[model samples]
Target: MSRRRLPELTHHGDRLPAQEERERVDMLDGRVGVEERACRGLLDGRLGASVFLVRSPGVVDGRGELVACTPEACSRWVRAAAEYVIVVNDVSAELEAAHRRAASVPWWRYVAAQRAFRDWKTIARRYEEVTREAAEAYEPVAREIGRALAEMVEIAAQERARQQDETRRHRSVLAARAFWGWSEVTEAGRRAVYVFRHDVPRDDAPEGAAPEESPHVDLRGLRRAIVDLDLPDVRWDGAALAETERELAGIGFGRWWRDLFHEDFRTFTAPPPARGSSSGRSSPSGGTATGGTGGFSGGFSCGGGF
Candidate 1:
């Protein structure tokens, strides 16, 4: 069957009335005071037992401080900070049963009663058993997620440092220009300073100041570096993302009883969670959850691809 093309998404657009249309939110919606996140687990709107892995972009909330960037401006750092991931999902048992049951009877009453239980307690007992088994099987996938996040954390740190240094270099030239009286705050607009410290004659050196170890960076140099800086040219590894998911199914999270949640691939989900709700637990079928389940859609393999 041909796949459906998803429309643009917006942050919190789900809260809008069903009739309202909105734009898609940027993958890196770096609003102030938000933090980065990585996740692996069950999501809402699915049936049976299934687990998902996610590496959504995080925000740079300055907290209470006034931020330099506008709410509409996505942070370049956020994109640099973004990581790739793969996620898997399935149809929930209740929903899957609803689908099959609806095929026979009116679509309105999807939940039909199965064979009568020997005792009412038996039903609750069975649910608890299914939940327990799911939790047990998910341990390895969870551990793998931890390992993956750790690896990504190291990578993020390096990226953050590189970006910060770039920011500092760009600012350094401006600061130096002001210090040298080239970009002085005068009645005339600030003057542009193209001269460097070394270009000035020795007599121009500050009295008694020793020679410098390195030249103060210039705007030209900063611009050149900005242009030449190597950006990573790949998305998250679909194969690797697919592998963890393979382990999840191999471990039997999707096979509990009916395995209703099982699908060929996931659908396009909204962007990953903000830090606070980013990482939490949920059940494949139904059970208590720390954070409410979020929605996701998958087209192919994992690693945070469309």
Candidate 2:
């Protein structure tokens, strides 16, 4: 079937009639408003229009030549373009063509639709069973492992602080050696004296006296101690395994029910309770009759052998 084109009205004359110019302007404005409204409606989830406008030299040239690019090329161009221009020459015909093309079913889609329910049920059941079994089997072990891991983390933090202190000490010794020089101790302290004169005085010392210092110890012993204090391997018990299994089972069963039923069970709704009338009256069993107004408050006779 032939496509119907959109009505086009143009005003070219320099001294065109006011009515003609107004008509043209109105048409253009209407088209712009339609496009904007469509975009807004789509964003707001109120409409489902897939029309896209492109405003690029390439698209203009293609439209002029009535050329259709490959889907991949069109996508790339659209992404790269800054503006989008309207070019709906035959909306109905284009829509019909798309419908015809979509009428052909793809093999994968058919297969997927056929297996979707079965797959959902199967997966749900399998996960539920597995989680239940795992929870039963591993809860106690998981708890024990968690406790051990926490302990290991605490030990690691402590060790890290100790290692940092050791590193700082080593760097301090290197800085001291650089400042004091090689001959500070053996060569009658000439180099040391020269360095001291140039450097700022230590906080603990008098202006002329050398800084009192601790005897230097090698870092090899410290490194060995750090290495020996490695994190101990964690062991799990039956109780921890049991606890983990229970948690896993809970999660798995919930998911399984949801998937199998294809409905959310997490939310529960209870109907409101039935209301009674303000009036009171005696029921057959001497209880207040519902929605009635003749009872004890109204001075009705009591059942005291009157």
Candidate 3:
């Protein structure tokens, strides 16, 4: 038996004709509306997130008919800038299905997942630029999928923290009201008192100023009430309360006032500094932590890995 040499694969420039490029671009444009619908479907779980290639670049034989070709040549063209060919069947239908499915999940969960998807897009774009090799396109896609998963988990964790914070704040507010006979006041006045106590001041006061002088309510009776109320176990030390008030004031009293007093206020707890990675995982203890693989999800998807 004699060994045989395989035919050389043509580069994208040679294989994909201008006419084909125009046709593919036109097809893609036509499919844009459907593609968007399909993407939404996948995000909403109405349609599974899977990549499919309906047509790949190829050539016609002398008989003037298209013919199947080897994967090697297809791979070459893909590397050489061949446009991805795909079809999104029933995108609108799928989106409707997804909308129905999404109704079962908590609205916040859906919103969190969407945010993660956005982050993943941003990270994907950067990954694509860094890894320009033809074989690496799938890597970025996989990374994006991973980011979406991680984001879901992170959102859940952050939600828990927020809930805890809200519980603590609620109790503290109740205690303050009880101790000061604040319930006797009108609802508006009671709210004002709570806002005055909880709202951190933004003036350039000395760092160690007394609580009363610091423009934040630091009544010992209020603190005792917060502890006695038997709220969820939150790390509500004097320092943390002060910091929270300061952060709230920095943003503006009116804007964050409602947020501070919201029933689910605890669910919006900020992640500790240690868990500040793009992946949404935090360090075991509270200290500086390095960025995790820069992955994101939701509307943030882009060209790179992080």
Candidate 4:
């Protein structure tokens, strides 16, 4: 038999209702906040699960009977896991970039050294601020994604139970036909089988049957890191800001301000060729802080192509 194509999924379009069609279009009207656009874009990338449904053996249940599942179920599992990983990496990258910006300036050492300085007192302050922002932006969305994943797991379990029941019911009807001395190839046996197809709830698994694996394992593991993130307790304090301003005015801030801008430009711009060097600026020692994504380097292999 020819395989059937499952329904196609759009990134963000399917999320809106018929009444909100205009609202989706209006998002490009230049009035949407940058933060909102960024969050939406991060959550709605070019990603989807498999498009075909095929049956295959899944994990063994508590009764040791290997459960069967639709291919889409496993595909969606991997997709949800991948999305969870991506959200965590995005938040980590944002926090790291903020730290780099603050630390790259020459005067950062001087400012960071003063523990009593409430304005930019601790280097931890930068991390705290960035983490809070990330949490506020992503916590709710991450929870929604986790909820979708748990629901998918439950659906798969329910479908497995239904299929198992159907198989048992068919077998029982065949047994009955045999006991009645009716050959399956005969007209009477075929009629019995047809009648049994419409039978409802005759072969449900008995009480204390095999239990399926817990869906919460994925939610509690590394896949659901965002849901378990330790959000910072930082908040805005006007008094601290006033103190920062007063401190800035007390020092020769004008010179330091110009140096800060210059340092930023130098740090970002490509270097000019070194004089009299044959091999053009022999790549800086220790490889010049390449800003690689080390956070996502391991343990992110999705079982299916996510």
> How do the predictions measure up, each by TM-score?
0.26, 0.20, 0.19, 0.24
Q: Least accurate stretch of 10 residues (summed lDDT) in model 3?
A: 29-38
Q: What are the runs in model 2 whose C-alpha is more than 4 Å off?
A: 1-123, 170-306
Per lDDT, the best of the predicted structures is 3
Q: For residues 188-303, write the lDDT of model 1, one tens digit per residue.
A: 22211121134333322222234344344543342232223322111111222233234333322112211322221121123234356533333342111211121121132222
Top candidate (TM-score): 1
* lDDT measured at residue 178 in model 4 versus the true structure, 0 to 100: 16
Model-by-model lDDT, in order?
Answer: 0.29, 0.28, 0.30, 0.28
Please report the TM-score between candidate 2 and the true structure. Answer: 0.20
* lDDT sort, best first: 3, 1, 4, 2
lDDT by residue for model 4 (1-306), tens: 001111111222222111111122111121111111122222224322211111122321232212222334334433433343344345444544434444444454555423223322243355345534545554554444445445656878999999878755643343233111001111212111000011112132222222132122221131122212221110111222222224343322222222332211112122334366342212132111211211111111122110
RMSD of 2: 35.7
In terms of lDDT, the poorest run of 10 residues in model 2 is 13-22
Count of clashing residue pairs in every prediction:
25, 21, 45, 0
Q: Candidate 2, overall lDDT?
A: 0.28
Alpha-carbon shift of residue 154 in model 3 (angstroms) = 0.8
